[model samples]
Target: MPEIKSVPLSRAAAPRPGSASRPSAASLRYAAPALLGYVAVRITGVAILLIAASATGKDGMHRLAGRWDSVWYQRIAEHGYGYEVRLPDGTFHSDLAFFPLLPALERGLSALIPPLGVAGAGLLVSWLASLAAAGGIFAVGARLYGRRAGVLLAVLWGAYPTAFVQSMAYTETLFTALAAWALYAVLTDRWITAGVLCVGAGLTRPVAAALIAAIGVTALWRLFTAWRAGEPLRTQLQMVVGACLAPLGWLSYIAFVAVREGHPFAYFDVQADWNNRIDGGAALAAFVVEQFGRNVFAGLGLCAAFAFLFWVLWLCVRQRPRQPLPVITYCVVVVVISLIGSGYFGSRPRLMMPAFPLLLPAAVALAGARRRTLPAVAVGVAALASGVYGAFTLLGSGPP
Candidate 1:
């Protein structure tokens, strides 16, 4: 595979016998540039948002941190669940459809810091999680490819069109952070860490179902191989334990919803209320084709969007032909769930943010650039475009 090679966890953890016992400083040195680059992109996006808000007499900070899904999360934090808003058209918006982990963290932090409201707490968590995400991305890239590729990987993830969500008081950053680290753990064969992070990711978003599936499939496959190879019973048992634990958080949430709503499948039913369900991309295709009838320009835009996603998926397959089973499974499942599930059309880009594996090919290209200036210019242009899009999306009518 041209993507990167996977290194085991113990090899990564252990230093040469005569070397320093830890690589903390080395990691920081490698990660600092990527984190700074990402934050710079986010700051530019915020600055654009601020200018746009000022010109329109709007509160950009509030819009950035308190509107749309941010508002939903804060509502869940401040006032528990069971809240619903009935639209004039008779459709209902219920808080129950949202996941709970991010809100729970917001609520806890808000209490810990009396001066910081739930929104502020949420932002705090989001920013920190974004940094952690960058680090995890770096770790994965470094282990798979090299440190340079790792740096590019982190920067590329931050340059995503929906990168602003990493800065907002949303669950994307937190979920991505957990998912990246969980994937890293899997790569390193840290079964316990992978299982725990998978649980956390599962708690943060329904998309975590994809992560759980990846972990389960990988663990079970490894367990069977270990059994056939006559590996130690303890070694096989760890895989079983990790796979078993991966889905608990998601299942627990469903049980809670079922109990609260007095139905066995109330969680799925609640999602149906919001027009979110798995329809094998029927709704997505309809959404794209309708754009042509309503507005040819938008139809072109949708075409470009679809083309871009298809290209990324193609790169994922073609560029990394020999990717580790966990990486391939995780990335493919993430794309499948993101595209196949029925949800708000506008939010699809944001939904795709967690599929960080899609960036691997781009990262490899950037990492392999002969002239340093080329990658720099590419990332710079991407960051600028990301900033403009983010500002426009946050300031526009609909939610991002």
Candidate 2:
């Protein structure tokens, strides 16, 4: 496979003697441009949002840290779970639907500073996590392609349509940060570190199931290859241990919910109340069909959007040097989960933010642009478009 030639698993698993164990000052310098570009894109997006909010007489800060799901996270931070609201239709909206890590962090930060409050703490966590996520993305791209591709990858991610969520009091940035670093750890052959970060990702969002699946699959593949080649048992054991640890955080939370609710599948039941269920895309198909029945243009638009997503996935798969198994597996799993689940349609893009690998092809193309200024111009245009879209959606009645 191209991946074997490009990034051999065995070689990554064992570092050379005298090499730095973790990112060093030089590594930070290397990724500074990508981090700076990402921050610039995000700042531009926020500035646009603020201007739009001012024009509409809406509070942008409140929208970012106090509205919709942010409210639920802050509520969890301020008071432990067991909060629920019943809609007129008799469905229960329970706090148990949210994972605990973000709230736990908000609670800790608020207590530490006292003046920051839960909302402020949540925003701070998201902002910092976004930068970390950008750096990790740069590292991964730089490892796979080159510094230029890596830089473009980070900038493009910041210019994503739902990139505004990265600046909000949301789990997307936190989960992306953990997921990116975990993938980087896997790329560099640090299985234990990957497992630990996977645990954190699992704690932050249900989407971490994708991350866990990626790690488990990669580890199993490595073990199979090693056994056939008669590789060292120590390496195999490390892979086994990491694979075993990957799902503990997600499973533990489910077990907690089950015990608390006095039902073996209480977690699923909680999610069902929120209309979040894995239905093999049945609900999505129904939604599209209903859209067609109501408005042909809206239905066509939805179909085009899905087609675009799959096209990007195809581009990712067709890259010159194949992506590592974990990267490909993780991206595919994230996309599958986003499409197959039944829930609020508008939130699907935000939920897929951690599927950063989807941007690899675009980043590579930008990096290889004939004109030196072409990449910058393209990224600038994308950032502007993203900013305007973010402002519009954020100011609208619906959740982004």
Predicted structure with the largest lDDT when compared to the true one: 2
User: Candidate 2, residues 1-400: lDDT per residue as tens digits?
Assistant: 1122344545543343444554431288889999999999999999999999999899998888888899999999999999999999999999999999999999999999999999999999999999999999998887776678899999999999989888899999999989999998887777888899999998999999999999998888888887889988686776677778889889989999999999999999999999999999899899999999999999999999999999999877665244778888899999999989998788788888899999998887888877889889999999999999888888886364
C-alpha RMSD of each candidate structure in angstroms: 3.1, 3.0
lDDT comparing candidate 1 with the true structure = 0.81
Error of 1 at 318 (Å): 3.2
Weakest 10 consecutive residues of candidate 1 by summed lDDT:
7-16
lDDT of 2: 0.87
Q: Give the TM-score of candidate 1.
A: 0.91
Check candidate 2 and list the clashing pairs: none
Clashes of each: 1, 0
lDDT of each: 0.81, 0.87
lDDT of 1 by residue, 295-388 (tens): 9999998899789888888867654533456776788888888888788887787888888888988888888877879788998898888878
Given candidate 2, what's the lDDT at residue 158? Answer: 99
Model 2, stretches more than 4 Å misplaced? 1-26, 398-400
Candidate 1 residue 347 C-alpha distance from true site, Å: 1.0
